[model samples]
Target chain A: MPGYPPAALLLEDSMKTALRKKLLRDMLFARRFEEQCYQDYQVRKIGGFLHLYPGQEACAHGVMAAARPGEDYVITGYRDHVHALVCGVPAKEVMAELYGKATGSSGGFGGSMHIFDASKHFMGGYALVGGPFPLAAGLAKALKMQGRDEIAICFLGDAANNQGTFHETLNMASVWELPVLFICENNLYGIGTSIERSTAELDQYKRVAAYRIPAAQADGQDIEVVHEAAQIAVNHVREKGTPYFLELKTYRFRGHSMSDGGAYRSKEEVEEWRKKDPLEILLARMIEDGEITREEYDAWDEEILSEIEDEIVPFAENSPDPDPADLTRYVLVEDDPYVHGGPSKGGA
Target chain B: MPVMNIIQAVNSALDGALAADEDVFVFGEDVGRFGGVFRATDGLQAKHGENRVFDTPLSEAGIIGTAIGMAIYGLKPVPEIQFSDFIYPAFDQIVNEMAKFRYRSGGQYPCGVTVRTPFGGGIRGGHYHSQSPEAYFAHTAGLKVVVPSDPYTAKGLLLTAIDDPDPVIFLEPKRIYRAARAEVPEEPYRLPFAAAVDREGEHVSIITYGAVLHEAREAADLLAENDISAEIIDVRSLVPLDEETILASVRKTGRVVIVHEAARTCGYGAELAALIAEKALMHLEAPILRVTGYDTPFPYTLEQQYLPDALKIFEACETTVDF
Candidate 1:
């Protein structure tokens, strides 16, 4: 069995200059998109819990870069807008979903926390902690049973590891030798509680050792580091037909949700982590390597901001609210015999 | 037609599903080589191979959560909980995830998982081993709750449940798994999610399902001796409850006695009573009476006293007829 890939192969000349620039562009776009969402929530245009993915852009971008989007299955926790966008779900649909519009990915039924786009194979963004663990394993089991090479990629937070499903699924995934990559975006704190306080074993990757799965940790702030580690982990799972765990050491720059004031953490701690911002680190690396001029980077940023403002925002704002008359739709299959005429005033 | 017990009929239904669709999979603890603790999946693994019918880790959440995932990927999975009492661990997954998959995803993902588990008390099993939890799932929308009273209903209803394009909680009456024997069709068949009018009468109506259906039959026979005609209706499905059938029976009989093995508090009988009171209040000559277990945990030593028996059903029917 292959252990964690050696660090000697890190940042080899394998990543082309063009790909690196594209990743940076994607990460910047995601950051701007989340900022736009935060603004929309403040204006009451986006309702329900809004979990912005600002500081953890590199995690989704890096892992998705290593896997075949729209083919391999992807599942994640509620902090999932960026993951959906990276998996090829249109930004307009994701925004519309947050706005609870019919044009949204889930037809407005599932708001921010439950984004789903089956066409993109982005299975879903589950709201319950540790709920996606076994679902991801099931997806992998499906692929293996069908003799398909596609693997299932699951993204969860450090706190979700405390859920019993985390242990049950890992053991099953290892015992069955399913093809799955379990990505732990360790943002240090699960909401207000710090990892050290909640978990006895602070190292999330070390927890996977009990299941006898190969595991590693990577710098989540740097896209290059995340991509390289993800590539090794993804390949190991697909080739060996086994599970692998990859923990990204990162931090969320914002509160857990829109309602949170984030008084739990010290201001200095927040500022200290923000100093290693993922976007700034990537931009600095590109500048040092002369990949693009600073002026060009500024112009690209402006163009993305304009697109979000002019096109994406308008699409979500103009999308229609779901019809109340069709409130009971999708409760069952479309042609279900009991769909239109069945027991009335029952539970759901 | 082949005469088989409820366990054999369940195994036969699973056999037909596995042979009919390559996507259908049967899995649970001790279901593969051991043929399930109740043997409801006996000889399935051998006939369908390990991949199609296999055992899983002893985790209800893992069993159900994985079934949802497979269902999302366009596969049919029939997962079993060893017992209904042990299903609480996966309650979140079933209620929050599996039941809401179709609704939450806007129909993009229809989780057509058929969760099979044996429930109700008859043997000396304690509270943990015996529990009728159908009311819990029936209370939740987007889930179909079905219970089988005999071999014929078991085979036909199991097949229909697997074919339905929604999640179903297929609760089997373990008490009558072997005792309830009848002639079941040899080939695949489907039974709609409606009540079956087991016997017809006019004086009083006895509505029941699962193992208690047999008790209701005994109660009906007892009523017949007294020249008091009684009707017996087996509620095959609970969620998409056939209210019309129940109401028509209520309208004809003018008296009702609902029976179930679950506790009386918030039991399925409550729903039936409320529905009758709401829709057929004018036709009712007497208040709807319920024959059910007490609002207490199932007692191991006094299980017979705890469960609703034929005598209980007979007394409740007599009271309704006299009123």
Candidate 2:
């Protein structure tokens, strides 16, 4: 696998053909995987809240492409399947987690919202709106305390900025000079509420100025733009050893969750955002640049779809459910006395 | 052994934790430089360096949230909330994130965060300053709720909490921070999360924790004078409750009186009462009574009246024994 290329390599002129192809493939796989999830949810294969990452693929793929997987810590909100995949968590494991199987990433305990792969440094996918803010800061604090060069990357929506923790954590991150990149995937609407209707200041990057942290905004529809901006943001945090905020202007194709029909959005609005689809933008860009033919792109898409069907779906379907007898296993550490039973016979 | 108050003992425990483990971090509001408002972290920053012992912004959520992160990254973070009453701002971090980390992650990340905070009423600090919120934490699963009654238990239990593999809510009885003193071990030692038989007896069993244990001791002394022979059980750890110790005492006494500084409606006392009623009801000869703070908000001038004192505990014990 091609590790995250340096910021200097991500420039439009210097970008490698292979790296560009890999970015397209990764985002294509994510898009297809999420579409599979939508189908699985409809067919009752996957249970619980399923947050699909379709139109906003570039945000996760682009930023993560600039991050060192299995080294740099990454955390995000509930829409996390693609993020976990970008961090090197196996697509099968993520699918298994959605299937609530024992072989899942979190042993089926986390379901859709809490995909975690500590081995890959994918911290987690938190369900709470603003819960990951302080946690991301904490991760960066740990990295700084240990004298490590790795930075913590936190992903959230435009609406999460309204949370008290968002303000509190950002202020603390700046105050402590922690190495963290706060990426706001500004999909315009947090669920049904548009950014204009919700936030007073529409520009999420401007809000970071309050904390005195350096920030930039980029078009999240284009993987090249997203990757270029993320590389700069990542480099800023990594080199300066200070927090940086990067707002990606993007849109999600689906609703907040599987249950949401997105009645709050107009068809014209959805169609308009769909026109700037992140996957199509990258694929079309590569084709226009004479990097690949239409037939090759179609062939790769088919391969990714087949892999999701033949491997990911079957693995999750065949995996066993978590045993009921071991229900309280992870409440504490395995060796903890309380895990086996309550208090001992007499007073300590 | 050296004689120290709860504050001194807590300080020593934190000092020992930082000295022993390079990964141990102590931080909170006014903890560094100021050495904490109550001086529990007194002189710690000077001794252990600013990085290990530091103060944080006054955001409780930020403090606990960052601590949770540090713990997830394999550091032992013992963060203070200044006062337990102020811990509500961090309730989401504590209840949802920290408590559920290990379980939700399928044991991949065990958040070993020992959140130290001063709790209980007394010393004239009204509503915000002195509220025993142990019940709130005790109700939360995946968290160990521990209360240190005096100096020795304070140091020992705190060390154990810091060393524990899971998240621990170490609620320090601020009421007895300076008032209660004892000869504590100089070296670091761990105390188990189980009740201690403070005073063993027969007629009546007094179940209590935190600063309220002192009142139970005084009540036991009063019962001794009246030849009641009250067995006092100091429930140091409320979550991993010492059920055997409590049940054994209740079985021997055949009468029980639960006590706590928190309000009575659904206090930790109610859990104890329910436990006794469910498991050891046949051994009981009388109805279990509870001597706890009233079901109202903690009052300022009426703090004395609101708190369950020795007289109240003694009365409750008398009622249980007489019944």
Pairing residues by index, what is the TM-score of model 1? 0.56
lDDT at residue B51 of model 1 (Cα atoms): 94
Candidate 2 chain B, which ten residues in sequence have the lowest lDDT sum? B294-303
- Model 2 per-residue lDDT tens digits across residues A1-348: 112234565554546889989988998999899999999989888754678999999999889888897789999998999999999999999999888788999877677778899999999987666779999999999999999999999999987787788999999999999999999999987654566655788888888888899888888898888888788889999999999999999888888777566765889999999999987887887888899999999999889988988999999999997775454356556766542221111112
lDDT of 1 by residue, A1-348 (tens): 333445567655447889988998999999999999999989988865678898999999999899998888999988999999999999999999888788989877677877899999999997667789999999999999999999999999997886788999999999999999999999987665576655778778998998999999888888888888898899999899999999999899999888667766789999998998988888888888888888988999999999999999999999887775444356467666542321112222
Candidate 1 collision pairs: A347-B141, A348-B141
TM-score of each: 0.56, 0.55
Quote the lDDT for B277 in model 1: 93
- TM-score (second chain) of model 2: 0.99
* Residue B203's lDDT in candidate 2: 96
- Best of the candidates, lDDT: 1
Candidate 2's DockQ is 0.02
- Give the clashing residue pairs of candidate 2, or none: none
